[model samples]
Target: MTIDGSHAEGLGEVEFDDEKHAEDRQFVRALARGLEILRCFQPQEPLLGNRELAHRTGLPKPTVSRLTHTLVAMGLLEFLPNHEKYRLRSSVLALGYAAAATSGIVELARPIMQRVVDEHGGSFALGVRDRLSMICLIHCHSKAIFTLRMDVGSHVPMLPSAMGRGFLVGLPDHERQFLVDRLARVSRRGGQTTQEIVQRAIDEFKAQGFCASYGEWLHDILSIGAPVISHDRQVVLGLTYSAFSYATARATMNEVMGPQVRQVAAVIGDEITRLRWRP
Candidate 1:
C-alpha cells in the first residue's frame, strides 16, 4: 500500500478456499462457498442475482443457487421477488453488531473518541484489519458540520486508510512483512507496489508516532492514525483522526491530530491493560 508522498500508502487481501486447505479434514467446502457468496454482495451494490453471485464468487451457478437457497432459508439472505436477486439480511448485520457489541475496545474508546470528534471536527475511527480492509468497530462522527458518512461496520481500504497504515506499522516485523507481501501481490495501483514506497510511512510512524494518508483512499481526504498497544494481550488497536484536506493540512494533522489520537489511543490501551491484567 502507498499513500501519496511521505504521507504513506496501500489496500489489499486473498481468501483461502477449500481446495487450498482441502488436505485438512476439517476443511468444509460448502461452508466456505456459502460464506464467499455472502462476501460477494458489496454494500454499494446491494442486490445481485444468482448469475452475478456466481460470477463474483467464481462459484458455479448450481452451487450458487443452492447456497443462496440455503442462506435465504436460514434468514441470512433475502430473496427479491421482482428482481430475482438476493440481498444480505439483517441476520448478516447481527453478526457484525454482535462482534462490535462484545468488543472491549469499543467499550473503552467511545468517550475519548467522542472527545476527539468534538475537538477535531472530523471523525475518529477505532478499527481492526480484516484481510485488506479496515473494519470500523466504532466511528465517532464529529459534531462539526463537515463530516463523512461512516459508522460501525464501515469498510475502509487498508493501504489507503490511516487506520490501516497504523495497523500495518504496529504489526510485529515478520507479520508486517507477510502482510506487505500480500498487499504487493493484490496491488493494482499502476506499478506503485513496492516495499520501499511503504517503508517511508513506517519510518514516519517511527519518527512521528503516527502514520498518515493524504488523498490515498478518497480524494481530498486526509487521515492520521496510531496503533493502540495493550501491554498484556499483545493487542494492536488501529485508531484514526481524519478530515477533509481543505480544512486540515497534512502537516497539521500529523503534528497535532496525530499526537492527540495517539494519546487517546494510549488511554484505551491503558484501560484494556488494566482490565485484562488487573491483579
Candidate 2:
C-alpha cells in the first residue's frame, strides 16, 4: 500500500469525519473536536490561540472559538489573558498523573529496569505504541553523562527508533501492514521510501528476537530493544536501552545490550501476564 503525506499525518492519530459520524447516534463530534483543540497544546508548544488551533486542526475559525471556549469552561484549557492564547490546564496533567500513578506495569518494571541500566550503562525506557510514535511510560536515566533528551511522556518515532521497531515487529501481519502503509509515506531514508528498511528491520527482529538502531533516529544515539508480548501473542510494550555511540560501539550493543534488553522484555512480559493484562 502507498500513503501520501496527509495519510501519514492521520496514521495513529484519531480522525473524525462528520459524514461517517452522522450515521452513529452515539458519536459525539463536538467532543472529538474539542479534544483535538486540547491536544494541540504540548510541553514544547504550550500556548496556542484560536487561529493557530484552527490552522493546526483544520477546523474553521468559528468552530475553534466555540471549542476553545468550551474546553476552557471545562477546565481542560486556560485562557492566557496576557498573551490572548490558551494553554493546557492542570486538569490535563491530572489525567496523566492519574494514569501514571495507576500504571501497574511501570511499578513492576522499575526495579528490573534499574538492574538493566546498572549493567548496560545507558538510559532505559519502557513504552507502548501511540499511533506512529511510542510514548514512554517509564524512563530510567543512565549513570553515564551521555544520554538522549527524553523522559516519561516523551514521544519516540516508530519509523526510526529501536523501541518503535520492536513494537511494530511484534504486531500481527495485517495490523503491521496497515500501520506500515500509513507510516511509509512520511518515513524515508536518503530520499528513498522506508519500506525496504523497515521490512529488513522486522525480518531481523523476527530472526534475532531484537531490533537495533545505530543512529537512525538521533545521529549520536545507539540503541537495542525487544518487545513485551502478551499471553495472546500481542505486543503490549517495548523496552529499549540507549546511549551515546561513542560511549558504546554498535558491535558491543549487538553483542551485549541486545541480550540484556531481551531479558528485561521477557521479565516485563511475564509480569504483565501474571497481572492478567488483556492487551
Candidate 3:
C-alpha cells in the first residue's frame, strides 16, 4: 500500500499497489479491500457511509456495500438505520487493544514518561508511523489546565509535527526516502516545500539529537521530539514533549526539553533491548 494524500485529520489515502502484487499468487484482493474499508474510519469521523468509504478507498460503491455488510455481520462495524451509516464496533477496539497489549514498550515507558510530565509542565507521548501520519500509542500529561488534549490513537501529520519528524528520522534510508517521495505529492502548507521542511528537520536532528517544532504543526503548540529504535533496528517509535506555545518558549525547548526528550527516548530504547520486546 502507498499513501497518496491525507485528510484534515491526517488519515492518509491508502492506495493498493495492484501492479506490484499482481504476480503474487498469495495476494487476496478481497481481504485487502475489506481491511482498507476498515482503515477508512478515523477518530475524528466515527460514522461513515458507503459513499464516503468508497471515496476514501477508491473502491466501487457496490464493493463497499458488500464489504460493509460483511463487516457488520462480522461485528467489526455497527449499522445505523437512522443515518444509513456505520460506526466502528467494540470488536475493532478489541483488536487494537489486543495488538497494543502485545507490545511491552508502552508498559515499560509509562512510568518514565509520567515522571517527565510530573516534573515538567507538558505532555509526553510515544507514537508510531501510520502511513503518512504518526499514531499515538501512549500519552501522559501534567496537571496543567491547558495541556494538549491529544491521547492514545490521536493522529498527527507526519510532515509537520515534531513527533512525526522524529519517527521519520528513525527509519532506514530507503524507507525514509520512500515516505519523503510520497509526502512530496501532498500539497504545500505555509508556503514551504516538502523537501525544504524535511531537510530542516534532518539538519536539526543531526545537530541537536532531537527535532523541534515551534508553532509549525499548530499555531499554539511547541514541541521537541526524538526517535527510539530497537537494538536490532526492527522497531522504531517517536517520543515527544509538548506544551502550549504561550506557556513555553522556543529557547527552552531547544536548550532544555530537547535533550531531555532525547534522553528519555534513549532510556526507552535501552529498556526495550533489556526486555527483548520484539513487538
Candidate 4:
C-alpha cells in the first residue's frame, strides 16, 4: 500500500525503533502514542500547542511536534495558521464510526442500550476490551448530567473504574490473579493501593453482579457497570450507566434505571449468543 502524506500524518509519532517496530505486526505502543496525541484535543481544550500536547500525552516535545505535523497533513488535525495551535478535525470520527460498525457488540447492543438510556434517565455506555483498557463503543445520553464527556472512541483503564471492575469480576480465577499481579505493579493515580482497589472492585462485583464507582475516573460522577458475557462465558462487552451525583444516581435507581441496566446487559448477552460469538 502506498503511504500518502495523510498516512504519515495519521502516524502521529516519531520516537520509534524501526527494528523493534518491524518485529511486531500490531505495533501497539506506537498506535497508543499516536492515539494519545490525537485525544489531547478535547471539547474544552479544542486547540493546543505542541508543548500542551506533549504535556497532556507525556510524549517528548520533538515527538509531539512531528506527530502534530503529520496529523495536520493527514486532515485529522487542523493547524490554526495565526494561533500556532492544533485542533481536531471531523475526519477523526471516520475512524471511530468505522470501528463501531465492524464491532459485533456495538452492532448488537445499540437498540437495547438505547432502551436502557430511555428507561433509566441516565446514560448507557458500551465498551469492549482493547489491550489493557476498554474502548467505548456506544453511548446513549438521557440527561445532561449523565452525558459522558467521552465520545465513542475513548479508552477507560482496565483497573480504576466500575466498567473495568465489571470485566474483572467475569474473569476466571487464574486470569484474575494474573491481572491482580499486573495491577500491583502499576502506579495509583489516587490514594488507593492497586491491590486494595482490585480487591474492593472484585468484592463489590461479586456481590452485586455489577460494580459502581464514585469519583474514580471523574469527580462528582457515579457509575454502575456490568459485563456482557458470550455463550462460552467470556466477557465481550462492558456496560455502564452513569449520573452526575449521588442524588441523581439514587433517583435513577429508584425509578426505572437500575433494572433496565440489568435487563439490557442480559439482552445484549443473549443477542451475542444468538449470533454465536464463541469468544
lDDT of each: 0.75, 0.76, 0.83, 0.67
Candidate 4, lDDT over the whole model: 0.67
Per TM-score, the best of the predicted structures is: 3
Clash statistics: count for each candidate: 8, 0, 0, 1
- Candidate 1, residues 168-236: lDDT per residue as tens digits? 887888988987888777665664654764686699888988888777767778888788777864777
CA RMSD (A), model 4: 7.7
lDDT (10s digit) by residue, model 4, range 21-53: 677777787666677887655333467899888
lDDT string for model 2 (73-165, tens) is 888889999999999889898898788877677788889988877766778888887767777788887566655546577667777788888
Candidate 3 lDDT by residue in tens digits, 1-279:
111123243355687866788999999988988999888777767789999998888889999999999999999999999999999999898888888887777789989999988988889888888888888888888887778867567677888888888988888889988888888887467687777877788889999999888878776888888899888888888888898888888888888888789889999999988898765
- What lDDT would candidate 1 get against the real structure? 0.75
Which residue pairs come into collision in candidate 1?
1-9, 1-10, 2-9, 2-10, 3-8, 3-9, 10-159, 11-159
User: What TM-score should be assigned to candidate 2?
Assistant: 0.89
lDDT of 2 at 1: 10
Q: What lDDT is reached at residue 98 by model 2?
A: 84
Candidate number that wins on lDDT, 1 or 2:
2
Model 4 clash count equals 1
